[model samples]
Target: MTDSDIGYLTPVIDEDGAPFWQYAARGQLRIQACASCDELRFPPRPCCPRCRSFDSTWRRMSGRGRIWSYVLPHPPLLPGYAEQAPYNAVVVELADAPRIRLVGNVVAAADAPLDSVDPELLSVGAPVRVAFTAASGGVTVPRWLLER
Candidate 1:
């Protein structure tokens, strides 16, 4: 199957994560920060995990990070993902917030196919920068690209 034949999955936008997707659509990466403790958190929650405060705010991120870990799914676990076998799924540790890690794919360009990056080139601790891709259904996804 071709890349066009396989559709990208849209993230489930809830009250806590709605701002994240909204910021991504605008080409800015924002994560939840605790208003009370000034702690940054990912996979946004209504309450701060650090201080248990219900008050939180959105903070723009540097979008610079390093690959903490990665995997090449050989037998693609999902239906659409099977078409993009050998693609790298990476866990990136943010430069400014080392404790905040995000999971995404590393591609050659913003809109490049999932398999654009060679799996051999990916390594733990490799520097990467964020890039956004507008997928089907008007959803924008944050992807990573190797930093030269």
Candidate 2:
């Protein structure tokens, strides 16, 4: 798909996710590593999910993972995602975490719908990794995929 399809990637840019996007623009995948317990967190937050420590550092990730859970959005789902109905919204278990999960999309196009990836090719525990796409104002953010 063309870049025109990646229209809704506007990251809210709150305290947590801003740095992650900043790094993504440079083609780096970042995850929050807790300074206290050394746990890696995703969906970006200040505190570590393990130790609940406010101290953390942004660690560059290997950008590799496996599908932990997933779903196909169907008719009568979230209206914004209806056009992309049957799109896969998956929770991936980062290789670094194995226990921690990151929710993202699985599509042929970074911004395309779940339908872009044939359901036959998707399954729990499938290999996946982080990918990036252009976003508003020339920024970039992470998207998920079945292949590199």
- Candidate 1 lDDT by residue in tens digits, 1-148: 1233345566767889989999999999998999999999988998887789999999998999999999998788677788877788899999989999999999999999899999989999999999999976677889999998
What C-alpha lDDT does candidate 1 achieve relative to the native structure?
A: 0.89
Query: Cα lDDT for residue 145, model 1?
Result: 94
Which clashing pairs does model 1 show?
A: none
TM-score computed on alpha carbons, candidate 1: 0.92
Every candidate's CA RMSD: 3.1, 4.3
**Which candidate wins on lDDT?**
1
lDDT of 2: 0.75
Model 1 residue 52 CA deviation (Å) reads 1.3
Which ranges of candidate 1 are over 4 A from the true structure?
Answer: 1-7
Q: Which runs of model 2 end up more than 4 angstroms from their true locations?
A: 1-10, 49-53, 76-80, 109-114, 136-139
Query: Local distance difference test, per candidate?
Result: 0.89, 0.75
